[model samples]
Target: MQKTERLVAITVLLQARGKMTAQRLSNILGVSTRTIYRDIITLSLAHVPVSMEYGPGGGYYLPDDYHLESAIFTREEAISLILSADISGNHNLFAGDTDLHHALVKLEAVLPEEYRIDVMAAREHILVDTSAWCNKTQEPTHLETIRAAVLNSYQLDVLFSDTSCCQVHPGAGMLWRRIEPHGLVFKGLSRRHARVGRWYLVAFCQRCRSFHTLRVSDIEQVYVHEETITPRPNFDLHDYWREARKQLEKLKPPIIFKLHVKAVARYSTLHGDVTILKEEPDGSAIVQVNAESMDDAISYALGLGADATVLDPPHVRMAVAQTAQAITKIYS
Candidate 1:
């Protein structure tokens, strides 16, 4: 029996039978007393509210008010439901954050042994976050249609409006294009420092004869084809995205600068624009500011006022100092 299954079984038994001793639970579940004790600890961590009574009638029992609506699920069914909830999270159409999270926990606590390891591994690799920068929901228009097309392996006739495309096709606003929807990804430039992101469709463009990552937001219209298409062979979304980001980084690398910011301003300094490298005893931090250019970097540091100072890239520091002196002259 897997740990999760055993934990769920223990929970059910305690809730139904009431006041089960460790030895009894161990014998019933075909596990050791030591294992039962550990399982009890795990249940507590998952917030099951299991309590123990001491002395002659000593045994573990759940509070009278605590109740779990139990359902028997096949191994595959449980795994799928758990992983789906894990990936989608409380964002998107599934907006019940608290309820869905707890439901996932309960479902995961009952997965059978054969499917447990694989499910856990899959969870680590797949994540779908639909949150925008300021804790706001940033869902794209026509996201539902695009998502359905990707899942069903359908071709799409899309009206795309890209500012960059305007140079090539002057006066052309929204271009009509056909594509085979390969996958959907929600990501930003630097995965580590990316707090803000938009949904992008990784599709094989029929006109371009190449795979293009099109911003879903920029897609003005979407028409799903009646006929479904087979998925492209040997196509891996993760691998494709990795190579695409590499090429993009080569074209324009991030402009990085060092900053020494007071703790009070640290929250404002971060704001998804910087990554902290170290923290000091005086409640200050050394952070690396990432931007598109030196001007952008200088502007960010200056915005922090006296709470932040540029430490490296002497030229940048000089520029920031000059800007500050000019501002001081205006006030004086």
Candidate 2:
């Protein structure tokens, strides 16, 4: 690569990979260690925060706060970036990052007129909404407070939504639980899906003496504390979420329901959690499904009309029968 490209590459590598030795940079850029050192000096002359450490784990690194002033992107890359910014729930994901907003505006201003038109056309064809259907999306009231506490390694005094009524009773500190904020988990989808994005505060609850995934919206009140606490040893957000989901599945096992399906065409409407046990000669099928409760099973059966019947689980079948009879009486 040319010297100018090599210099830019070095800057990007340091910024992306955090730290690298001269030998590693030389090996990556197919250049000599001397050339790598010269490139580092050139970047330093350009006011890049390139620093080095001398020790067993020493390497060349940019400061933690160092950021590139500007970036160059190809046509495809620019389109991808602009579309990502456009469809990121209109700044909902970033939680009102003014820097990001300004950066995007700058990027748009620099794009050529032709490229700008192409990007706008692409946006018109493709739209992504990350919210759940039926208006189930929840916005946390104490998101900023929890976010600050997590960033500063501070404890949070939280009142969970476990009371008898909708209002908090203004109880003593006995009711407020203290937690060491570990991280925040935003669970949501990108496509047109049913699962809406919900913010969850993962923390070590001192009262329970265990890790808890507290829903942000359900937190009635939160107070950030001056007392900072270190995170748990080797705490990983993705690993904790995976293990927590496994335990949750164990706690709430799927309720199986056996069903006799009549109209095969309507079978496509069934939920994804289904298993066909047997198929009859009359195009009927016996299937098993998982529901949360008997009421869910009844509703599922009723939705199919005469196309399906809840066979096993006597109570669900009885409930479906009673509901059908009541509906028939109303029609008569």
Candidate 3:
């Protein structure tokens, strides 16, 4: 478990149970008593409202009237969160350092008496299961290590596969990269119905002298060096990600397609843009839409079926005609 997660757990435990001895906290968190002592000290330093008591049965606890500013989730909000945590395939957000069941136990303990019932009712009532039907969720294995390296500002040695497309195959040539990792992106699976995620590491590549994004799963090895790093000047992680997405978009020139549709012209614009240029005498709409490629444009037009006709672009018209002929042949 991460130190940050452990501190949060300790704070929740102390606030919920009134007081717990360091030894007990150690037992609960699976750490040494000495580590608990250190955490208590750290919490105190961070102004977490934690205090230690000295006596036979004494331990560390928060003052009754005292609570951290962050401990302000309302009963409804808390229940919603607990409900979300209970669902399988939820992000490790609620389950970090401990399972949701245990975390909810501590959470309910801290809640006011009136809220406890709501929490319990929510636990029994609502269920959200996000696990894919066809495939199990695959958690990225190297995300933690890479995130740690980024947070600690350590130089990282990465041995990654030449291509992410066939990452499982052994024969993909190895590429050694040294980077000062800045951010991690939990991108959705590029493949259809894939439950697994593809984690991308955004880092300053020393060799390339520019920021680079690489798949974490494709990375065959990771070596975090102790030496501190100098982060690039004026490089914002969010900005970089946005710019990278734009670059990817520019790879294929978008198409502007002209169409005449009998109806559902509005729906054609959902994925891109559709502007009504004119309305035909026969109650049809003449419109223009943008698509990433000719295939996308053709597919969108096809989806409109006989209701839509390609008005311009001779090449697209030819392709659609050929496709229509093929369909007609199959039917005939």
Candidate 4:
């Protein structure tokens, strides 16, 4: 590894642990012990708090309060960091507000003149129109506290808002919930919409004895306990999510209905998953969809606007007619 890379690697290693021997650093960095010593001195000169111990099993250590400064990142690294920070929802994972901001400033300072202009231009011109359903912002501190509790295998007293009701409630709402913090999953598409881009903590809920989806937004507060819980044996998060998706899909009845839609092109393109049974030359399309009930199917057809005409089971057409009558009554 290059001297610069080795320096960064050493810093990472020290942060993960408190100390590393010269031999271990050499082996990890694929360099000679002498080179490692040289790099350590260089880092020390750069204000990296590096300490050396001398003994039979001596090694190098960084002080508990040691931190990397802004000079560590090159211009390219700085730009990447800024872009990442702009999109990162959990900014609190990094220590200190000033640390992240200072890093961003350093990155901007070193950005290539042309690249900086291009980035500014892209930001100015790009317009992202998100849908109304978007996820809410989660407080970084709350998420971190919950994560720490999960990591330490401790139970948490959480103040949570139940989605079933629109009010916030406080207490040790869910108790003695042993959780093995598996991971966090980002769900939804858009960040701007209230229900879009929400984050969920995916953990094994000991109280329910099942996997529970807790929205980050619903978590009002988290209090960590001293207890720990053992993780499920051979728990595969990937398979768990796959099965979860399937179960959710099964809950929604299949869309099955027949529609003679006038805007054939528009309807087919939008509801292509619903089989197109036939088509007419006058720009009309005959489509069939399998749904759990007539009400559900008709409601879906209505969403297609005036372009759609239901030609299915008699009961479904009658339901649609009744809906139209109800609308006419209100208007008239």
What's the TM-score of each model vs. the native?
Answer: 0.51, 0.58, 0.51, 0.47
Model 1 misplacement above 4 A: 1-88, 92-135, 161-173, 188-195, 266-286, 292-306, 310-332
| Candidate with maximal TM-score | 2
Residue-wise C-alpha lDDT for candidate 2, range 94-208, written one tens digit per residue = 4554444455566666678877888889988988765555565556788878876775578888888543121334433325678898777776522225444568788887765
Report RMSD (Å) for each prediction in the order shown.
Answer: 15.8, 10.2, 10.2, 10.9
Q: How would you encode candidate 4's per-residue C-alpha lDDT over 151-182 as one tens digit per residue?
A: 44566655554331223223434433345555
Runs in model 4 deviating more than 4 A are 1-109, 133-201, 207-233, 264-279, 287-300, 312-332
The global C-alpha lDDT for each of the candidates, from Candidate 1 onward, is 0.72, 0.70, 0.68, 0.59
Of 2 and 4, the candidate ranking higher by lDDT: 2
* Shift of residue 293 alpha carbon in model 3, Å: 12
lDDT of 2 at 42: 88
Clashes of 3: 0
Stretches > 4 Å off in candidate 3: 1-71, 88-96, 99-105, 161-173, 189-196, 252-332
Enumerate clash totals for all models, in the order shown: 0, 0, 0, 15
| TM-score attained by model 3 | 0.51
Name the 10 consecutive residues with the lowest summed lDDT in model 3. Answer: 188-197
Candidate 3 local lDDT, 71-168, one digit each (tens): 44556666665564465334542234454356556666667767778877776776665665666666666777876676556899898864422333
Estimate candidate 2's alpha-carbon lDDT, on a 0 to 1 scale: 0.70
